[model samples]
Target chain A: MRHFVFSLFTLLLACGAQAELRVFATVPEWAALARELGGDRVKVYSATSAFQDPHRIEAKPSLLAQARQANLVVAAGAELEVGWLPLVLRDSGNAAIQPGRPGYFEAAACVDRLEVPSVVDRAHGDVHAAGNPHIHLDPHRVQKVAEALAARLAEVDAPNAATYQANLKAFSGKWQAAIARWEREGAPLKGVGVLVHHASFTYLTHWLGMKELGTLEPKPGIEPTSGQLSGLLARQQAAPARMVLRTAYNPEGPSQWIAGKSGTPAVLLPYTVGGTPAAKDLVGLFDDTLQRLLQAVR
Target chain B: MQKRIAMAAMLAATFGAQAADHSELAAIRAQIDDMKRAYEQRIAALEQKLAQAESRPAAKPAPATVQSERTDSRRPAAGPASGFNPEVSLILQGQYKNMKDVPERGITGFWPAGGHDHGEGAIEGISKRGFSVDHTELVLAANIDPYWRGQAIIAAIDGTAEVEEAWFQSLGLGHGIGLKGGRFRSGIGYLNEQHPHMWDFADAPLMYRALFGNHGSYTNDGVQLKWLAPTDTFIELGAEMGRGANFPGTDRNKNGSGAAAVFAHVGGEVGVSNSWRAGVSYLTTQAKSRAAHFAGTVDDEVEGLFDGRSQNFIADLVWKWAPNGNPKYQNFKFQTEYFQRREKGDLTCATPEGAAATVACDGMLSAYRTRQSGWYAQGVYQFTPNWRAGLRYEQLDSGRRDFGDNAAYLVVDSYRPKKASAMIDYSWSEFSRVRLQYAQDKSMFGITDNQVTVQYIMSLGAHGAHKF
Candidate 1:
């Protein structure tokens, strides 16, 4: 019995040593970013798929199992995961990735957020007091988060610090070049008035200089009513938007209805990595988004 | 700067060509305003980044040095003003129940367990014939420190308040070990740990009512220890020691623990949509002089007292499925649990002091023993975002009863008990729900009750996520 116990302990230690860093990301975009920074030195897992709403994901047992062995947990914090992340962290029983620890990294904390509400009230529907958490759409904010994530990786897995830094440098250089090209190619999209299904596209429109006409839903998380849809239609007929924008996961009914009534195009943009077939990575996400928007305008 | 000046020059040339178009001019002005706001935001972001960088430590240190610094700075020096303020939430619940007015209610084929009974005008356990307040709970939770987290749930039934749960859990216990102490719901079965508000139906299963009395759950003051295995699949083992002061056990004034329990659970996901968990548990306790009231065959009330050892074995399973791992619109969950109990002890049955004894007790103590078992199965489906429907069926068997030498006075029944319930609930938001439930309850051997209940539950403060 003693020998068996000793062998079991040794086996657990060997398993722990195999993975230099186990990263659990609450969203796919963060998982993609972690993979880019920790190349070969880290094992990354995404708790939610690109086709799932981040705000409403359940704290399933599968996620808890992943969190139990994770050396780092990446989340779009600022209350984006307020509903489920706390429960996952509390129940994981893994001390390494609890809040305020070195292993826990929040992407939104690394950048300035938009749409911060001064008066926090549910009367305005489900409003995040810490501002909009869709910071990944802005490539600049993604770059900022990359720097912080790289630093965090180095802190947790010091043996791979040099590798992490080198990977960060290479990723940043390529990403900056891609951003420049996208900006130049997307100049035609400047000052284009668009209607969005939700405020999820706030950072994206802000980056590309698109004007947001209105939202389909009257509030942040409330479903759109027929009365509200007709109101938006009336406003659209008076000052027509060029297109209606929605993510791949959003319900297509409202956007299609408005687009049909206004005689405009309804565009589906890939909100994250793997959201669409062409959006297989970070660069492809923006490329596909720009391509879809350009197609709509043409 | 040069690009802006050139754009302004181009706009001026356009204006010179189409000066008569007022709508075009207004649109150009709006575009210019948008550009101005965008630039201002960009500058502000850059300034904020600069400030952050300036505030960071200047020296680039090695990883070892950084680790030491982080260890030293485990707790934040300055917390938010409301950091000490706990997350407080209140659940408001009321229900209108329509059923027969049975003055005294008890499941027929089961031994009467001891727990909280209804307060005031509640003649039929938790509900009456008309409108009544259900269990309204006020919960407060917060991280006590770097090493501990604490929570308290106070429940108000009718006009009286009771502490439902108050516990502190260790937050920094590594290696998948967790420690908790205080009064808490026993983690014996899947449904036992969840509060009534989280139940899919308005009422609990008949099996629970038989085992833990009308309260439908077992709570005790105890210390619990749990260990989670480090594996891809979820495996957890837990053990608890508690003061056995509630149903199926009695408060035997002793120095050590009177009740002990151990449980193990295994779970995993199948493909991308379905997940399942299965668990088995065992509990043992000692009861000294437990009191119970039962109706005799002649409608006379009989008093029974028991002193003995009781043991329970339970098995539970839950399975859930959502399309593409997204449950925003549709999902389904099926859960089932089975409970078997065995008890051996000396039982004394007699009439109350003021009542006449239809059956003579003769002051005789009989060596009585019994083995009983119960099981329930339920399923809930959410077809839309705001609507859900559920159905549950439960049955109990009074397997064997032996009242040696006192069989005439302590009568045993051969009848089995069962109930079937169906419910539909709609939620306008995550914090509010209204449910309509109907049940055909035959748990009380001779009576088959058709019951209807309409319940409304509203949460007034902090929103809590339900555990899977």
Candidate 2:
């Protein structure tokens, strides 16, 4: 009888805990943005961390558990999580958060995507047919996504619409100012050349007007062979880039290898909101990234 | 007015003299026009050629430029979906196994232990002592539309291919109801549905081997329905009905519908990094004359036929912890499962007619009753980004056995089998891993086998996510 009472008590507690809107975000950057918009109205969970590669993750039971109760699901859905997110959503068994619902949001859908392949072929390696999903790196794009997401949060939770709108207004003002400041401070890197670990920083470079030298992995998902590395090295030597750029989640060995060979400044940029110690929020994310790029140029 | 008239008259006189000059001027004008037309045509042709060349590289370098986006600010989207290409993937596995000895061919006094025989060339978990290609799996999966998705897995072992799993699941079944039909792995225990490619260690647990051979009693040819409760806290109830063709079952079901199972699971999170889930499942099957062949040394082999009803119960629990729910650098997972099986049936034992028989029983029928139970517990720690270590312990108990009149004639040993295993693996990335595992197996009555295995699993192309 006591065991039954204890079990009933715990079950009630669980039910009470789940009354708040539960949001499951695929990556941390979106989680941060959602938190800023939803405030205390929603409990946010991120499936992947800043340190983990977003392309692949084990769809663990905990993630499914979180998603099963989620009121909203957010993802950078240009096949960035093609490996796992679809499966996770399907298994979550939550009808409200399924695709095409107001409770579901794909940030990539709102952005004018970059790199839409004109032709169809798999020889180029793993490519997103919906274009690049790494739009969070650009402050301007992130601001647009934030606005859309805030509206989404409001629509999902009608009672919190005012709070969501207020949050968006404050965020937009602060973010636009930060972008202007970053542009002014980062003017010197406009025409500077760079090598990168992957195309993760494409939006960042596009925003800054950096001259792209090349990539270690010329194919998006394939590892660079020795011959490919040597070719990259030759190109870098002939026309030296000022910096070798990589994300916090990328492997350090390959980027450092060529950086060491070419004496280029190796820059590890915080790719997301929580990617680095200083990058604790959306504003700090851009500040830390611009600062890192400036250090590399210097 | 007089000066204008004088100038007009002079112009006319000059014109009369220069009429031939005017014709020559007309000829020159025509020539200049022709030359201009010719040059314009040539320039147009060259411009077309230049455009063609430039467009060729643009079409080809769309992917290259996306990668080289370090400088240029061109945002290129990778076109639209070209029809549908099913996600195709290939998994290759190979292993080298070393055991203290060949080990006993037949398990001592284990019931319903059919389908455990390793083929002539099989090597990884239960086969031989030398190097061998374990198995290669080809998988194809895709969404049929918004309402359904399908997947097929084919495994090739020893140069022969067999269909492993082929199923279609409903996509738009609302209200947390998911329906699937066709051949699929049963969602009974936590690991039952997981393929060998995703196993933590080099081999399966001893309980699995003794219960339903190397492959657990997982794959079923039938339909399943699952319902995730409308409430929170992750409660799911599932049930299955299958054609009784697999072990613990046989092909003797003339009317079919020989097996059925039901399961329920609940999970919750404790903090930022800790989560746990527990479940209970039950499976029941009716068998008629299920055939089992036990290999004995030097032609003492025997074949047994079982006819009976089998009931199995499983309880599983899994716990996971990572510092902040990201297992990139470090994480820990502990999983354990207990299973109890009950079977009451009649067995017909027979010996080969030709060679040398230890004790000749051409064909003898006996009424039998047997009960068995087993459990396995394992823990894995991801010490670093690329390295992991795991330990597993397993034990199986042959509870009780009764053979009516043939009890004295039958050679059955009363023994419990137990084993312990430890392994460490390194993963280069998500697609490849190499694992080294060691085990001390004591399944036979009086002999113990110390085993070592080095295995490699490589995945190429796309394999859909195996669910949590």
Candidate 3:
């Protein structure tokens, strides 16, 4: 019995030493970022897919289980995950990943946010008080988040600090070059007028200098009513936008209806990694987005 | 001859002074030139260093330009004055119920253990007829500190208020361990811990009504400890000890804990679209002089008192499915729970004063033992974003009753009680919902009550997220 117990303990120790770190990401974009930075040293799990709405994901048992074993929690904070992340963290019983700990990383905190409401009220329909959290759309913002996340990884796993830093430097080099290329290629998109299904493309539009004419939804989270759709249609007739923009997860009904009525094309942009078949990683996401936008205009 | 020599000396002296002054002026000019050259070289070096510093960042213009642009547009919004205040929410609920007016309603084949008074036409404290305000709840929650969080839920009904739950939980206990203390709903069964406002139906399940009195569920002052295993699949073990002052067990003035319970749950996902959980629990408590009522021969009422130990076991299961794990469009959940209880001790039966002499008037105490069980199954489906429908069925069994000497006077029916309910609800948003429900309750022997209900629940203030 003593020998068996000792062997069991050794087995557990071996399992523990196998994985350098366990990362729990609240969204696919952050999960992709963590994998890029951590490389082969970390086991990462994403709580929600690219197609799921981060604002409404349930704190399911599987998520709680993943959180329980996580050494670090990477989130797209700024209240983007306010609905479920807190509950999952509280119930996880893993003290290392608590809000104030070194193991907790929020990418939204690393970048400047847009659409900050002056007045915080639900009357405006589910507005985030900390500003828009869709910072991953901009390559520059993604680079900033990557730098901070690499630093966070080093803080939690000090022995691998140099490796994390090397990884960050490599990622930044590739990302910066990509940004330069995209900026040059997307020059024609400057000042292009567009309509969006939701306010989910603030960073993307801001990056490419595109003009947002209107949104389908009357507010942030409310579904578009027919009256609101008609109002947008009338506005489109007066000053037609070049195209209507929506993410892959957004319903196709409203955008299609408006596009058919207003002769402008409807463009479906991959909002994150794996949002489209071509968008399998971070770079592919922007590539597909730009390609679709450019196709639409042509 | 002396005058001529002095004039020559004076001329020589003047010539010497002019030459020395010329050399000194040339030397001063050279010194000024050297100083100008040194200053020019230093300025050039400093400018070179400045250009190098500036060009270093310019090489990576993406982050620099984006950073500057971000700072240019970054307008830090001022948060509300009550940012640090605890989250407070109020739930307003009211319902209109229609049912048969029955006097002295009780479930047949089941020993009445002080549950809701069905005879008074109240189902889970909701009035049976006409319109009435249901229970309204006010909830406040906040993190007390780095190590603890506190929450309080106050329920108000008919101008009176009561603290339904006030508990503090340990926040920083590592190693997958959690501790909670104070008055809380016991974490014994899946449905036990959920507040009535979160229930799918307007009323409590028949099994819960039979097990716990009008309260429908058990809440007591207690402390609980839970541990979650570090595994791929979800597994949790919990134990609780509390003052058993409600339902099935009478409040005793003893010092130590009057009840203890332990439970374990395991769950996992089948695929991206489905998940399931199963749990089992056991509870034990003591009852002293628990009061109950039963029918007697020829339209007579007998009062029965029981003193004994009660032990109950519960098993529960739940399954949920969504399209690609996105529940915003459509989802379905099915859950079921079964409960079995055993009680052993003594029972006494007696007749009320001014009543004619009847068999119950013998007033005899006898050794009593019984085993009773019940189960309920429910399913709720969300066909669209704003609409949902649900169906529920429940039944109770009175397995055995050994009343001993009191059995001759007390009445025992060989009937089983069951109920079926169907409901549909609409939610314009997450904060408000209106529901319509109909139920056929054959819980009482020889009586089948068809009930209809319309209820509305509206939430104000902080939005609370639901947990699965």
lDDT per residue for candidate 1 within B79-104, as digits (tens), equals: 11224688888988878999876655
Query: Looking at model 3 chain B, which ten-residue stretch has the lowest summed lDDT?
Result: B69-78
State the lDDT of candidate 2 residue by residue for B1-468, as single tens digits: 999999999999898779978899999999999998677546544543443233211112222222222211112122344336887889999888887654344456675344434333223333567787866899998778767789999988765788999999876776778899999999898888888888998877777766666565468899999988755477889999999577777666376588899999888677757778899999888877676554443235666667898888999999988766656668899999999988888877766344465445446788878888889999999987679999999988878877665555555567888889999999866678999999988877777888899999988875567666
**lDDT of candidate 2 at residue A1, scale 0 to 100:** 100
Candidate 2 second chain TM: 0.79
Model 1: docking quality category: incorrect
Off by over 4 Å in 1: A1-17, B1-82, B114-125, B297-299, B353-359
TM-score of each: 0.87, 0.76, 0.86
User: Which run of 10 residues does model 2 chain B get worst, by summed lDDT?
Assistant: B55-64
Q: Which ten residues in a row have the lowest lDDT in candidate 1 chain B?
A: B58-67
lDDT of 1 at B17: 74
Docking class of 3: incorrect
DockQ list for all candidates: 0.19, 0.18, 0.22
Residue A194, model 3: lDDT of 94
Candidate 3, DockQ score (0 to 1): 0.22
Q: Quote the positional error of residue B49 for candidate 2 in Å.
A: 20
- What tens digits encode model 3's per-residue C-alpha lDDT throughout B404-456? 87776678777789999999999876777999999999998889999999999
lDDT per residue as tens, model 3, A51-142:
78788788788988999999999988877877788888888888888776787788876765666555677778878876788889978789
Worst 10 residues of 3 chain A by lDDT: A111-120
lDDT of 3 at A279: 89
